[model samples]
Target: MKVIVGLGNPGRIFRTTRHNLGFRVIDKFRKRNGLPEFKSSKEFNSLLSRGSFNKEKIIALDPKNLIVIHDDLDLPLGKIRVSKAKGAAGHKGVQSIINKLGTKKFFRFRVGILPQQGKPQGVKKFVLKSFTRKEEKIIKRVVEETVEAVEFSLREGLERAMQDYNK
Candidate 1:
């Protein structure tokens, strides 16, 4: 089974914020694959759905393939980085998942949301704030690319995905 999880804070207010990029990516992937809406699961503390792609059993959630999609403050906006068995780098949501799962042996697709440089905003404030019109346009494209990367990872494997999508 391949599990894909997108890490994000729950609630309508956070829906379009930079911190919610993970959720956005999952939504795109689900819609592209013709899957039904994700149902909220208290057990997982996330929205979840199950389906198959290319004959593989897929369980999509907010935590454990557990593939985590989240925003990174280190990289420039719209950049995508895929890693495996890595540390959370101070991301609370990712840390929570790591703690709950008691392992970091899963794929992570990090979408960069940081401005290039010279921005005067704090990380917390920036991530929680809604994206500007320009950022949203970029995010729209990045989400599609992320969906493609996820599919490629599943169809091929993690190594190839990292090589092709990581930047």
Candidate 2:
């Protein structure tokens, strides 16, 4: 079973923000599959949906998968990286997940919000901010890819999905 988690805060204000892009993508993925409705699960701190993808048991899970997603200031904006990211890249959301899951070896479809630089002086504040119109266009594309990527990861194998998408 593969659990795909999208990282973001739990609030309406945080929605549509760059930080919540991960969650947004996941929601898109769930809706695209036309599976069951979401039920609030306190254990995971996010919505939950269970279904199959490409004949594999695909579980759309959030909150818990949050931990395994690393905090990397390395990835460029509009890029989504999937992998077994090592350690917490200084992200509280990922850190919280690590603390909850007690393991780092999990799958996370990382939605990049660009790296902190001179323009965005405060990383925390910037990440929570809304994305620009241009960025949104790219995010939409990436979100669609996220669904495909997760389904690919489940059916083909993580190695193949990683190789294909990481390109």
Candidate 3:
């Protein structure tokens, strides 16, 4: 089974925040593909839904497969990054998954939300804040791209998804 995890804090308060981009993408993918609704699962510390892509079993686990998506201070908003076997970069959620999974060999889809200028005054506060109107537009596009990349990854391969989406 192919697992896709979107990383984010769980709850209604964090729904629209920048840090929840991973969760947002997962939801979009679910809807776009007409997958079943995500169900909360404490076992994975995420909202999850199961489906198929190219006849391959695909399971999306929120806060797990999308662990890499976040407000990247290094990359400008709307950028999509794919990596594998990398450190958590100090993200508590990612770190938790690494600890639970006992490995970092999984794929990651990171969506950037930082400004071109640089990180804001407080990193945590900035990530938890709601995106500006302009930022939201960019995020919407990126989320769609992410979903496409995910389908490509499942249909082709992770390497192809990385090469195609990690621009």
Query: CA lDDT of 130 in candidate 3?
Result: 89
- Report how far residue 75 has shifted in candidate 2, in Å: 1.2
- Which candidate has the highest TM-score of all? 1
State the lDDT of candidate 1 residue by residue for 3-115, as single tens digits.
77788889999999989999999999999998889998888778888888889888753333667889887768999999989898878998988898888888899998887
lDDT value, candidate 3, whole model: 0.77
lDDT of 3 by residue, 1-167 (tens): 66777777788999999889888888888898888998988776677788875776766443334334444545678888888888888677777877877888777887788787787788888888988998888988898988888787877887888888775
| lDDT tens readout by residue for model 2, 1-167 | 55766677778998888778767877777788776777778877866778866765655444333312222345776676877746667778777777776877666677666743423678888877887888788778877877777767767877677799888
**Poorest stretch of ten by lDDT in candidate 3:** 62-71
In model 2, the clashing pairs are 67-97, 67-98, 71-89
Error of 1 at 154 (Å): 0.7
**In model 3, where do residues sit more than 4 Å from their true spots?**
60-71
The whole-model C-alpha lDDT of candidate 2 against the native structure comes to 0.68
Model 2 lDDT-worst window of ten: 63-72
Point out the higher-scoring one by TM-score: 1 or 3: 1
Ranking by TM-score: 1, 3, 2
Query: Pairs clashing in candidate 1?
Result: 3-65, 4-65
Clashes of each: 2, 3, 6
